[model samples]
Target chain A: MSSGIRVASLDDIPEGEGIAIDKSVTGTADDIALLRDEDGSVWALDDTCTHEDASLADGWVEGGYVECPLHSSKFCLKSGEVQNLPATKNACPHRVEVRDGEVYLFPNEAP
Target chain B: MSSIIEPATGSGAGPSASGGERPVGAATAAPRGALRRPVEMNRNIDVSGLVDAEGGLLDRSVFTDEQVYRQELRRVFAPSWLFLAHTDQFHKPGDFFTTYMGEDPVIVTMDRNRRIRAYLNSCRHRGARVCRADSGATRNFTCTYHGWSFDLEGKLVSVPNKGGYPESFDTKDWGLVEVPHVESYRGLIFGTWNPEPVALREYLGDMAWYMDAMLDHDDEGTVVVGGVHKWVLEGNWKLAAEQFATDWYHVNMSHTSALTVLAPSGKPKAEIVHRTGRQYTDPNGHGAGFPVHPRNRFDAQTVHKWMDYDALRERLGEARVEGPLTNGHATVFPNFSYLPVNGSIRIWHPKGPDRMEVWAWTIVDASMPPEVREAQRLYNLRTFGPSGIFEQDDGENWSECQAIAHGFITNSVPLNYQMGLGSEREDGRHPGTTSELYSDAAGRGFYRHWRELMNTPAWHEENR
Candidate 1:
């Protein structure tokens, strides 16, 4: 059951940056990170890194990759593939959309 | 790999360029200012033994065990925040100072953009130390071995005989390994290798309030005198730190002779009075024993000229001046300690389980007059310098205790730490855990924190 849920508005996330949405949101139980790529495309991934529990939202984002702050492992948002050492497993990617200035997230099942 | 600076000098074809030359590399020796290389245990380490803090019992072997010391280098020193250098030391770009975090040599320098950075002193190639000078301005550090060079920012800039390596060699992956975290409080800089350790502010906790009295009293702040007085002690580093933390009890016995000479009457005082002061031990293991001189103690006795109570009163007001500016001793957990009385600040560098190097500095308010600064320096030399009367007395006791730990029968028994146990209570006058001036609250708390850190592996697989 993949239902579209509005998570935030465009104003909540600036361009070329990412923000973490977790328990702060009333309906969201698990962590879901929403990122706005440099190309203005919105992407979502499981907030926690597979290698370590560090939040991907806290990781540095450049272009399509988010580098883990813990060990500098770069993970690609599109393919969910880790691009650096110390992190061998990929993050789970989810479907994201922007409609009428509202951001919607379809959470992906954890691997 | 051999780029000779002053060729051969007086040797037979010293280190031929074709390699296969000197069996030992030219850079085998440590750099000019490097401390003695640390000694490590050849056998496996076991840290299963514990210190029962609440029970007031500590295993004697914790101070003398070789394996436990090895574990401490990684578990306690590497992960926790350790004082590296002071910001005042770096007046301009390229200025740097070489220091030790545990036994690991590190260089703290200011880059061209004036950003301070800390790097492992070891070279990326062959592990020879990169920086040699103790303190100076430098453009780059060229490894005496293999002729590899690193820029001020610790980036590998040039490598001699580059064509000898494979075509895929990448310099990006070979820069000097940097200490991952660097932060400063007031002017003191600290670095940590642990990626997920607590924030520096939180690590300091309430200790910052007491430190502010010394470092941040005046608007200009405190400045460390130019040179450092360094010496080696044949004792575990913790003994010195713990003493400074919560052992005011030793002052009477340890310096009884010196007191008789310095006091107006040439007699050992019947009883020492510390009614003006209180002791505090933070949960983070930081501890301080500060004397609150009644505003009128300035009139009854002579305070150090550098202490300038009148100036303090004007700047910080009477309440703070009485609370923090008075004579006191404090330890910022693990090793960094300072005495507000004589302006002696030091780091007890753990050389091994049974040895430590004490590097001390005399700090004064940067705004103080030249005469006051000189008096402060002289006072520090007389009281806390390597050969000072009080320092020697303390050293003798520590060395004797360490010697006893070497014996089989001596180290088998547990030592007592029960002074003021189960008697500590919260006091409104100060924050954190408070106890009487003469108590083992800080000592017991120190060991508890040590046990937790020693047991908590830095690289635990658990998330969060």
Candidate 2:
């Protein structure tokens, strides 16, 4: 079953960008990739990339794709389809919600 | 496939492209470079017999024969794909870096399109290297030997005798001939003497998986940083790559000095390394992986002081840190090694049969803070660059190894690669999906393929 929770509010992420927060869920120290769409909504995903194990939160966000900082491999932020050849697999996107002007991530063990 | 580029897997070629003195292709008459082609022992080679469960025995002739060396230049170095500098090396339009494609000097540049291009360094008219500054921004390359200028695209834009030459000499036909095909598998650039060769990525195969890790998978995205540290060393190209590819066994002895500096406890170096990962051999005979780090000597030196042991723990998390902290080295066949140390990529490229010109670059996340970049570069230079204590010392021995092997006696006697011959474990089991590194896994794998390529005709494939 997929865990659900709130991560951030609309004011947290400005337009045309992304934010990275520590993930303490999964019972292991992990990264939570937090991104806000132009419409000002909260989204979250696993920060560790499956391809090269690099942190996806540190990657560049443009349009709707996140370009991995290492090799320029782009992944669609909305769905995490590996948008390039260098990366063969998709990133794990997490579920999120915005409640009371705060972003709370689901399965919120905060890993 | 008519291109003169050497076959990557299929070692055999027709008589014209044959390995040795057996005349082949446009090279049948005589060689243009310092070396000559081999006669491929021009028979239908049975590669099966050359190597075995142990590995191929590389005749010293393979390393020192002037004729065989020439043959390698043509069949191996000439046609095969050789790496050039990375795209990031040339940051500006006029930026250029000079490297060798065999003995031929080449200048890699960034054109107006920001696309990468390379040209034979020799001038079109008088055959002198058109430009020489090691690396810098130049609007165009003007031949110092005789003032012929060419643009970054290698188009012969200026010639002295514009109107003087008879209608015979055409400027359009004399453009700086590009080095066949130039392509980047990730940010790593490679070129070939032939008109075309396989895509660089396809040539890498499973090797690409690790290359992605070394070049891409990082928080900030790794980059080619500081600058390349170049210095000449005396050693055959294959010898150098072979040393890394399959000769982990040699590290205990060949680099015994490293141990003295590293641990200095009078312990066996190999055991102290804490190496893991399967030492795999690609179908074409390329070798990779020797997961031996954190514990890798250089890392051991820095982990406590420079690198934040805890920050690293937080960043890499627990999985990667404990597992392949020293991920197996990723060898790029022939003569290249992608040394990814937790988070750095060091590249090695050979210039000729002996005497390799090294190019060292650090791979780090693009978003890395400058201090991190500086630390990585310093670590890279300290361990492998010219200033590198290890490299400078290794060069003295490697070059001397070739020079001492100069006589017919040393060249004729076969070198013994028989270490742990019967005990080497097979590919039966492993987590890293690699061959065992307990033995000289890289050495056996490299020599076996060297003989296959050296013996097989350039035009023939085992199946074809």
Candidate 3:
């Protein structure tokens, strides 16, 4: 019972970093961070850090983990599990698909 | 979610035989007769939901509830081991200091026997405080109210008018009530009122290993320098205690503006956020988190680094010196906490549910040269005393949070504590439950212990 939306093209995001897309996970237009790992797989999570009101897009992404720039709390790119202290809960993980060179997002599933 | 809290309406399960009554040594306005009567708290106020399956739950009532505070005075503060004074504070046999066990005023002393003891500050006859001076050396204390004099051992020595009382009135039965359990570890003194309870060593558990990092740095040991600094904050005591115990996350955000000025180099704000540290949580509600430096870069300028680092390494070994004693904050159970390198030890004395009196001291190596000790003292005051840059910012955050929790709806909402949830690991270098530097696992552990003590009225080792 979810819907898919086209968020970006394969060429729109860099291979080892993430870009913020102006789309919401639950249809109300919230910011979602579209991250491309070094292995070339794209993952989408809510741009906001769950611990505090910081932006995940402004954080540093490396080795399949995104480190919150404000306090350095890390979140895993694959499982969305919080990788460090300060942020105790998992970030919202979204499904991503690349077809016909266009990146699609399915974000109704909760993290 | 099925509520784990028993209905506040029902009697629920009470504590063991010794638990139903409010144990002696806790502060109370009522006399002994009233204390003996059973107090029925709001049984319907189930706190099971206060902590959640995800990691943390918000129950602002713990801070604002009148009923809950009353329970804490009995169920939590009464049996818990509380900080009394430092060992060096009273070196002479007759030396004594006045302090608090919860809200009750007490006198901690080194009697003629040279044994450390604590007694209720209230005079036995009329309940007025017997000892008035903050600290001094006196053979005995005389009650200003009625001239009832007590010896250094807290024994009733003389009464003004002997004819006023009957012949059967023995002075032996009228001495100030002594605190039941008194214990010391290294140089710190702690007391409790539970008649039969676990020893302080068992109560502190593995946290003692971490504590040695600060207390056991050298064979000469640590001493309290620069007397004491006292202040009042309009916040709950638990907020202050919990922050020191497990809230390293708040440092980068709350102290950002202050850190900018304190940074050794230019662009201080950037330096504050770039550092890394690990958090440790214990089953006993004790937690500590400290920044791990590459070869002691953080303390390079301090007196600690000036001392023999190689000697410390030889004494405590590499892992201990790096893990617990380096550069961070720690708390022992309820209220005693300290910063390792910064060297400020404090007790958050609870005054009702929303207020606390902070009694702080600066700790330094007793054997250090006078100039080096003075340098350490000045640094401590500059960094963590009442007027310190970091201390001011921390007090503001706690006070503001307390103000918001007073709201009707806001008090019921759970606060977010989900940083680094389910991502804890077992690292040989670190002890207890180890997690990433930014996780709230320590906070969760702290609250879990709080919940356990709040629910169980007794202070048995099993319950702890």
Instruction: Name the TM-score of candidate 2.
Output: 0.64
When only chain A is evaluated, what TM-score does every model earn?
A: 0.83, 0.70, 0.83
Better of 1 and 3 by TM-score: 3
lDDT per residue (tens digit) for residues B1-464 in model 1: 01111111112332221232221111222132456333332232444466999888898888998878888886788778898877778877678899999999999987665667777899878988888888997667767776677777677766755678888677755777666566778778887767556778799998887787778767777788759888999999998999999888888788887676667778754443444466888888889886555552321122353356677778766645766565677899889999876778899999888899999988877887777677777777877889887889889899889877989989889998898888677777676677877788888888889988877755522231
Writing each residue's lDDT as its tens digit, candidate 3 over B1-464 gives 00111111122232111332222333332144545433333232445667662556657788888777876776677878898888888776678999998888999887765667788999888889888899987666777776676777677766766578989777766777767667778788888877665778788887887888888877778788878899999998889888887777887788877777766674564434766777888888888887776465334265855677778889977876666666788888888899987678999999999999999998887777877787778887887889988899999988998988888888978787788788667777876676666777777788887777777745422223
| Candidates' C-alpha lDDT | 0.73, 0.59, 0.75
Model 1 CA deviation exceeding 4 Å by range: A1-111, B1-49, B268-276, B295-320, B460-464
**Model 2, B356-444: lDDT tens per residue?**
76666666556556776667667666666666655566567678788877786777676766554554444443222354665555567
Evaluate residue B119 in candidate 2 and report its C-alpha lDDT on the 0 to 100 scale. Answer: 72
Per-candidate clash tally: 0, 58, 22
What is chain B's TM-score across the candidates, in the order shown? Answer: 0.86, 0.76, 0.88
Q: Candidate 2: which docking quality band?
A: incorrect
Point to the candidate with the largest lDDT.
3
lDDT of 2 at B150: 69
Better of 2 and 3 by TM-score: 3
Sorted into a CAPRI-style docking class, model 3 comes out as: incorrect
Candidate 3 retains true contacts at a fraction of: 0.00
